[model samples]
Target: MRASLIALVLALSAVPAHALPPPCSGGQVYEDRNGNATRDAGEPGLPGIKVSNGIDIAVTDAQGEYGLDYVDGRTLFIIKPAGYDLAVRPDGLPARWRNLQYHAGPALKHGGIPQRQPDCTHFGLRPQAAAATKGELDVLLFADSQTSSVKDVDYYWRDIVQPLVGKHGAVLGLTLGDVTNDDLSLYPEILRTTMSLQAPWLFIPGNHDLDFDAAGDEDSLRTFRHHLGPDTFAWEEEAATFIGLDDVIYQPGQTPSYFGGLREDQFAFLQAYLPTVRKDRLLVIGVHIPVYEPGARGFRPADRERLFAMLEDFPHVLLLSGHTHTQRHWYHDASTGWHGLQPLHEYNVGAACGAYWSGVKDAEGIPDTTMADGTPNGYARLRVRAGGAYALSWHPARGTDDSGIGLHVPRVLRKGAYPAWGVFANVYMGDAETRVEYRIDGGEWKPMKRVEQPDPRLLLENMRDDTADALRGYDRSPEAEASPHLWRGALPTDLPEGEHAVEVRAFDRWRGERSARTSYRLQVGEP
Candidate 1:
């Protein structure tokens, strides 16, 4: 495995950086007319060449210079038209994606002031551990390290993941799924880069990482299994029994779609296997798509039921998964009077490819898609204790200047039934006595009413869904599951609206007084 990874990077070293063609204006197209990126003598720009900014698309000018207003630090790249090459930086950043400080792009700043790079890193993992030890370990989860070309792999390292070398305390690493985009051949380079983190790494199957040329799902993961050991297996560490499942269900001609189930024999194997394992030990279920996600693109209800039935009786279970390119936390409580098992502690770790690698880049050149609960491209470091209790910490791959201080925004606001501007804020900190406040448009801060005697477990669990399963994509209504501990109040009606700010600050378990502020830009009606 190590040798393959080394070979992959060595191969990528051969791709050379090309100069960019001169910038073109709207209504024209530019090409490597001289077979070079630079616009040379007699190289005429082509009109009608399309340039895009994710949502908006425009054409280039006859002079080959195109202009469209853009967020400077945000990721900007041509869609890479067929038969044309994009100019790449020395480190391999696509020519259009320049001005990045580090690979993850640039940081966000407002009004000539650097804004809060949310500490998306560092959340509390379960199976509480007071200290780090050999037996107690945390797994670094990565999803879809897919690169289209060898040079693209260099971009991932130079721009995205190369910063994790000699990271302080992570024990093992696991790539959740999609190790490659479509080139199963590129797995070596991806693995080699990750292995540079100096930890034992494991790989899982994503749809793209599968062998489409194979006849069926069973054979699809054959190459993957050979590269990363058994497709379905378990490892027993001191804290928990980590079970890896080959849940990549493939359909013929569908390419990368989930439409199958665990083989009958694997189901039987797990049934027999679970009996041999200690029931008291915590079971960390690692899979790709979550069993219960808020989108239609997740698991089927029946599939979840089957998996739940398998471990329904087991206590101290935490399901760890990442497929949805978003961050969410859900917990189950038997005492909460909720129906069904509630799939306790359903955490959807945002992808390393945050928002499918979308969003604006930062000064460091990485996208902010991996923001806290909607932050930047990052990875979670879980610390599992001796008793199976753990805490989670997020590390922004591109944000921090190696400080490892990620954003900690326990408060998120949602507009309620008042004016279009009326808002309610949900605060999620570990402290029970922490005071919370909100201010709009630099107005006076107002104290929020707090309800005492709330269940911490239930409080944390309820935050995942504040609406019905239909609306919030959960099994219950948000009102029913709403925790009174999370402050909810109306916005002042007298205040005029334009661009307002909502900030929530509280002392958490770690950071004494952490806050998350969001800008709300509203337009008022004509008087």
Candidate 2:
């Protein structure tokens, strides 16, 4: 009798008296190394990582593990970190850090990383319709739209953000951090403008967005979270899992403006969630600061190893970020194993505000938004295909008519190879006259190609104001005997073969010579 009663009790327990249908099917999961809402490797489950299929309040555990039982089809994602970067798969999905040689899909999906496609497509790339089954989806990327005050906000709207309002194609749009220029209050205005995008818009914090009054590290971003919601969170769209993290950890005594490390809370959150990522969907990480090195800033050697180790297993991963306000592409080879088998694509986008709104205003009354390195003020569009192919393009803001941004002569000797040797380049001049040249081992500076095409908008900012001379320095002079937008050069062969310095100079159609020539280092073959 006793054994039968015990068996009966066990059976009863197995059959939940009320068989609530499983929450949702096809839901996604991720490995959270840190249990905090952030996706770091230390802390456990967090307060705000987003989960769908009926919105169960999701939090990570002390062990950084979370299992939303029966959430099969819902999208699960992490809030991206601020200073850190997120990894992405080729299909526009978020790539897991582990096994990252390729995506997590079938055998046909894997391949070595290739050079990133340029962002030359239309200023706006549409996302695949939610119902569409065949082609890839699309995502929109904007680097720092950092605005310091209401006036800057106006510039953003009138010059850049306003133009993107009602467009379609990308299901979601991401701003790569530095949403404001020390004005957290402007976040709402920023969102209001971004909401015009008609898609889910997400943001990451930048060094300028923190609070200067927080008394302790625990509450540093209190006002920010209270207003901006969670600093980091995730969402799923179509076949991709998206994680947003707050990597801007503030030091106890440092001024809020100082930038240093990722908070332990975020790491705790990631530890709890990473293991639960769904096997089918691609992972897309959206963060503000770059996990990889920006050419301008060199490398963040301390956090690199920790970050790589936490995400080493994922097969498909792409990291997108903006901080340097320049255009750069970084590719990591598989030899050192910084990540899994997949090669990581680190895209550091140029700023939307364009050199801190540095130059003169055009007919639109907006400043010329071009970087010192020559990347014009613009936003990027990322497209993700269902089969796992992704592409990127840029949409430059319309600026001046005299000059614009375009490709420089392809370097025979890469940048920095020769200090004195420089290349001349130009933009927006309407098939205008141009020239180029170089010398190696003290050879003559021979002219190269004078390629010209329709100038992208970013390359043509603020042409109307001949009266004010704010950005007059940035103007290219076509007649100074030396081109501001063009370079003439070949590396001096006398330098060491391993790598040498190369200098580039340019003159633009505006008849204004640049303040200085641009220079970069190049690698030479050992004889």
For each of the candidates, the C-alpha root-mean-square deviation to the true structure, in angstroms, is 22.8, 17.3
lDDT, candidate 2, at 357:
75
Candidate 1: global Cα-lDDT? 0.51
Model 2 quality (TM-score): 0.56
- Residue-wise C-alpha lDDT for candidate 2, range 364-473, written one tens digit per residue: 67776566555567777777755345656556764322223343322444333344443444432212243333333343545545423222223333333344555363
Give each model's whole-structure lDDT. 0.51, 0.51
The candidate maximizing TM-score is: 2
Question: On residues 1-527, what C-alpha lDDT tens digit does candidate 1 reach at each position?
Answer: 99999998987676543222222222234454433455456656655444443224444566655565533222222322322334433322223322111122222111111222211111011121334334467778776566666755765685556776665457567777766676766766776766667654656576666666665555566456434544455545566676666666776576335542455545654675565555655677777766664334445556666666777767667777776554556664443222344446755665676544433344655433432232345676676666657666555555453222222222322323234233334343222454766676667878755543332333333464443253332122112233323553355434444555666655443345556666554444443
Task: Show how many residue pairs clash in every candidate, following the order shown.
Answer: 63, 148
- Candidate 2, superposed: residue stretches over 4 Å from native: 1-135, 255-257, 279-281, 294-302, 333-337, 399-527
What overall lDDT, based on C-alpha atoms, would model 2 receive against the true structure? 0.51
